[model samples]
Target: MIPSLKNILIVCLLLAALPACKPKTAGPLPPQIDYGQDTCDACGMVIDQPRFAAATLLVNGEYLKFDDVGEMLAYHMNHPEAQVAAWFVHDYLSEEWILGETTKFVKSPTIQTPMAGGIVAFADQAQAEAFAAERNGKLFTLDEMRAQVHMVEHP
Candidate 1:
């Protein structure tokens, strides 16, 4: 038996409505790699590098982009205590990578910033004084008693 015009119209409407029955979420496919191997230089740990992990730190409008783990570690190591963070970007050139930072070779162990208070211990008072003078800071030496003992009460 032939279907009525009304029934045919209903069937056509159902077919059209079928597409809207299920919702579709659209996005680019997930990145194909495990980013856990990425490391941090300052804090000395691994970084979680993901697309949603975007962060920006600017200085005087001259900005440095450190979305990847390698860049962040480099920034942190040089800055030492600078409030910088990083993640990992896949380097197609050299393949294998770890947490690292770009650093200039310096003969002395000077703190990168004035705000950074680094500990430099010496065996004698004179040597400590000399080092402090060279570095432009107050210096102290480990006394014979304090040298042997690990902890002491500060006056």
Candidate 2:
């Protein structure tokens, strides 16, 4: 026998009230990173080896990372059109690192720029550009950036 109209309505209401059978989100959004070895996927250079990776990890609100700063410099040097970018670093403090999963892949990187006619290193992009624009200087080339690294800083 067919169920009564009240029962059908109740069943419909219950189904409606229940959470839609939508699939649960799988996990945290995947970071735009290459957890691979310390190498720039774009240029195939060892990351963070020659220089610390410095790039805009958040570009237009999107997560990003460079394998290292050298690569970021190289990329911008090669392509001056990049508006913003990101870089990845190993997370020694993460629990995942303890589990052997490694938190080295990047979700985003802090943005920075070169400074002082390539003489000084500024911690922010605006400073670098201001110095460059005001002084009639240009951004450091990848070679220049590499050459400026002090042995004390790396060692």
Candidate 3:
């Protein structure tokens, strides 16, 4: 038997509302790394330090984990063809994940990161500034970090 018009309308409304019922997501999320077990995609070193850990989310939904923030930048520099969606780094103080683009970075030999990357991320600019001042490091934005990677790798 054919459905009534009222029943069909009800079904249609429910279908329309189904999408809204699902939880909203803020786009693609970074992957969780199993420290000491997970290895850096670029350097092939075990990612044991949360404060120095970094990751890149590619457009294809692949996560490239890194032992150091500088390694992540170097990966992108070498693989310029990579289609990156987002970057994630751990705040040095909190060891919490933060968007790399919006985060501030400090670079210095004194930082003592894995693979001698010497770069650390911070969610707060003030905190980064303080860290840089204490370590005699230079503050860098994401773009500047990319350029700095070249120098580190080449030199």
Candidate 3 clash figure, as a count = 0
Per-residue lDDT tens digits for candidate 3, residues 1-155, read 99999999999999999999999888668789999899888767789989999999998888899998988898788887888999999999999999988999999999898878899999999999999999999999998888888633432
lDDT by candidate, in order shown: 0.35, 0.39, 0.89
State which candidate has the highest lDDT: 3
**Superposed model 3: Cα runs more than 4 Å off:** 1-22, 151-155
| Candidate order, lDDT descending | 3, 2, 1
Which ten-residue region of model 3 has the weakest summed lDDT?
146-155
TM-score of each: 0.26, 0.31, 0.82
Q: Report the alpha-carbon TM-score of model 2 versus the true structure.
A: 0.31
Model 1: which ten-residue window has the lowest total lDDT? Answer: 98-107
**How close to the true structure is residue 69 of candidate 1, measured as C-alpha lDDT?**
30
lDDT of 1 by residue, 1-155 (tens): 99999999999999999999887864212223334764333333344534211122333322233333323333444553444332222221233321112111111236231112233233234554565577665532222211222221112
